[model samples]
Target chain A: MRLSYPANVKIILVPCTGKVDVMHLLQAIQRGADGVYCVGCLEGTCHYNQGNLRCRERVERVREILQEIGLEPDRVRMYNLSSGEAPTFVAYAREMTELIRRLGPNPLKHSKPSIRLEEAA
Target chain B: MIVAKRKPFEEILQMIAGHRKVLIAGCGTCVAVCLAGGEKEVAVLAAEIDMARRLKNQPIELGQTTLERQCDREYLAQLDDRAASYEAIVSLACGVGIQFLAERFPTIPVYPGVDTCGLAVNQDVGWYEERCRSCGRCVLDRTGGICPVTLCAKGLYNGPCGGTNRGFCEIDPEQPCAWYAIYERLKGQGRLERIRAITPVQEWRDTVPRTLLQPGYRKPEKAKS
Candidate 1:
């Protein structure tokens, strides 16, 4: 089944979302990605039993880290859908793109006026 | 193994606030296993620090390295050539490793990235419960292999107190009463009589620096001058 999602959403495929590490999410934002979202298998239906569940925890951790560092936690998210749910997958992709659009660009992307950390503090 | 947790990023960011170049250090042994200051953690932290500093418009240059064990002089020597060059070093090891790193490179300011908690048992992924307190004495023989000092909220030596409600400690309803668990364990082992014997009060004195002299090691006397 052919379906289309936002062209702006660059996909990075993993064998299973469980392989997505916390650093992967953080690095994406650090390198100027406006947002990052992990789409794992439906909660209990993960083929690997707990792969998707593990991914969910890592996603939540990254979200908390983002929030703690003074950034919007909403920039990162976790969505679960089954293999048969192509329409749901497209919907999630579009929804993620829309959310990121509203959040504007990542704060790290554009440089602000030069100021010492002491002054910035 | 030693357990530790990363410090709040805001506090870590402030630790090297004035520094333009920094080295983020990590330990591979206990911290790595505990998911604190391992190689992956160093990379994640370096990325975070880089992004945080850049957002503030005072971007910092971050470098990182993870040693096998930061507590040992042999492993700390791996950073010998590079440790002295950084403006500040952020160590993600436990307190012992941090002190060792600081001692090795006295001129550079060493800041801790993680708080060392205690010896723990990994109950599950990302879940660690304290198992030992390093009280310098072992009394597991009397307590049926359970440490009363660590498991008992009151650190009582005799047995469970009035606060041992059912099988849980009163301090935290979720925590199991140490004495109750000990009793159950002894009963299972057919050594229930162990609980009846009075365990003498422990001596908590520390007259000399608590240093261990393992076999085949240099003595602490420094060759008697």
Candidate 2:
């Protein structure tokens, strides 16, 4: 199977997407990621049973946390696809990249210094 | 265990808005088990607050720490030196822990990060149900270990009210009638006779603000040499 997606997107593989935690997504945004999304095994087909479902829940939770903190919840998403469906995976990557491109860079990226200064004051 | 849930993020933002530096103190005991105010929750909250402050251009200095048990003086003592550095402290412990911190650090303001919900037992992963009202009485032996004070909406002592429909409570169809449950449980144990016994009016005095002093530990009468 051959497929191509945007080069800008980076992937971090986890043993199981269920292992993805709320903090992991928050940290990604804190570290300047304009957008983040999780690609998990298709719903109900997760090798570890509910791992994909758990990932989906975590993604939604992170989205809520983002909204609470004044960020657009659309910056993050969750997509499900089986291992054999490379085309769908590529499509999701392109879709996420397009979404992020529209959202622009994360607001917290350049404000690190100002935040620290205000904190100290 | 005492269960709680985090306050809405917007309310918390409003609370610490005036302070530039704030410390989020988490408890590693009950709140942690409930997934509300544990170490992981503290980190997530810290990051979210930092981002919110940054977004508002009102940047705040955030610090995070978790004590083994916020209810204990020994664990709270760990925050002594650092507590002074921050303008305010956001305690992620239950109501008790928050008050203790406020009393110990009279100079610093302590805000509650979580609302202490109630005494509950985990029904399933991420699910909890209240199990005890701390009514200052012991009736479990007669009630087949089910607590009517906590489970029954009316806190009926002798039996359920007429509001019971089948086995479900009238207040909510989803909830099983506590007295019905007690009846079934006792009947199964060949103890239905207990239900017929009239329970005396509960003494309300014991339910008031009360303290228990362990009788075993009295200061050893000044040891005479």
Candidate 3:
């Protein structure tokens, strides 16, 4: 389908949503992507059986870590839908983009270069 | 393996609140397998702390390194070249590893990021249950494979304290009575007679710090003096 989604919703294609690691989401927010979310195949219908489920777990893990770090957990999320639902995909994209706008920019939008602790000592 | 649990994130943040730079060291042995401290956990923590401090406007420069084992001097030597650069260290190792890191880096403040739980068995991912207390005594021959010292609420050596309710301990209804399990196991193995014999009262080890010297590692009697 030649449907349009928010252009700001930069897409990163993985072999499977299960391929997304916890670090990937954190790194995005740390590097100033105000928000990050994963769109995986609907539950129980992942291409690789449990890949999408695993993706959900990782997404939840990142969300929890965000809360623990005193950040908005909603900044990270996971959505599932069938491949044929292009409109739903667009809807989710718009929804997430709106959510991020409401949450404002990631506080870490401007990170100083990370240096070794020893260098500081 | 010695199991450990990570301390609260707020506690960790407080431990380094005054420091502008710190190192989070990880251990790759027991704590790693238990998922409390490992390469992945270290990176996740580092990222969390980085973002957290930034948000607080008290940004910190954090460094992370996962070693093969932090308890051994040889492995810790890997950080010798750069250990002096940090004002503080948050060790994501067991209590022993934390001590070892402290001993190795005496000048810098060393804080424990995890609480050493004790010996445990990994039943599954993110699940670890304590199984031993390392009391410096082994009595498995009489108690069957179930450890009375650990499983029992009172750490009884002989038998249950009569608080067992339907095979579960009265102290914790969910936990099966340690002695009851021992008796059932002994009965299955046709070794019920072992439970009948009273285990001699063990001498209290009042020594503050216990040291064990392997036969080959100990000095000869003549040289011991």
lDDT of each: 0.86, 0.87, 0.88
* Tens-digit lDDT string for candidate 3 (A52-83): 99989999988988998888999999999999
Write candidate 1's Cα lDDT for B1-225 as tens digits.
999999989899999999998988888899999999998888888877887778777888777888888888888887777766679999999999999899989999999999999999999877999999888778898788999999999898898899999899998999999999999999999999999888777776664557877889877655331
After the best TM-score superposition of candidate 3, give how far the Cα of residue B183 lies from its true spot, in angstroms. Answer: 0.7
DockQ for all models, in order?
0.27, 0.42, 0.50
TM-score of each: 0.89, 0.93, 0.94
Tell me the tens digit of each residue's lDDT in model 3 across B32-93: 99999998888888888888888888888888888889888888888887878888999999
Q: Give model 2's TM-score versus the native structure.
A: 0.93
Tell me which residue pairs clash in candidate 2. Answer: none
Measured by DockQ, the strongest candidate is 3
TM-score of chain B of each: 0.94, 0.94, 0.94
What share of the reference contacts is kept in model 3?
Answer: 0.56
Task: Give me the runs in candidate 3 sitting further than 4 Å from their true place.
Answer: A113-121, B205-207, B219-225
> Which order, best to worst by DockQ?
3, 2, 1
Worst 10 residues of 3 chain A by lDDT: A112-121
lDDT of 2 by residue, B172-208 (tens): 9999999999999999999999888887768876566
Indicate the TM-score of model 1.
Answer: 0.89
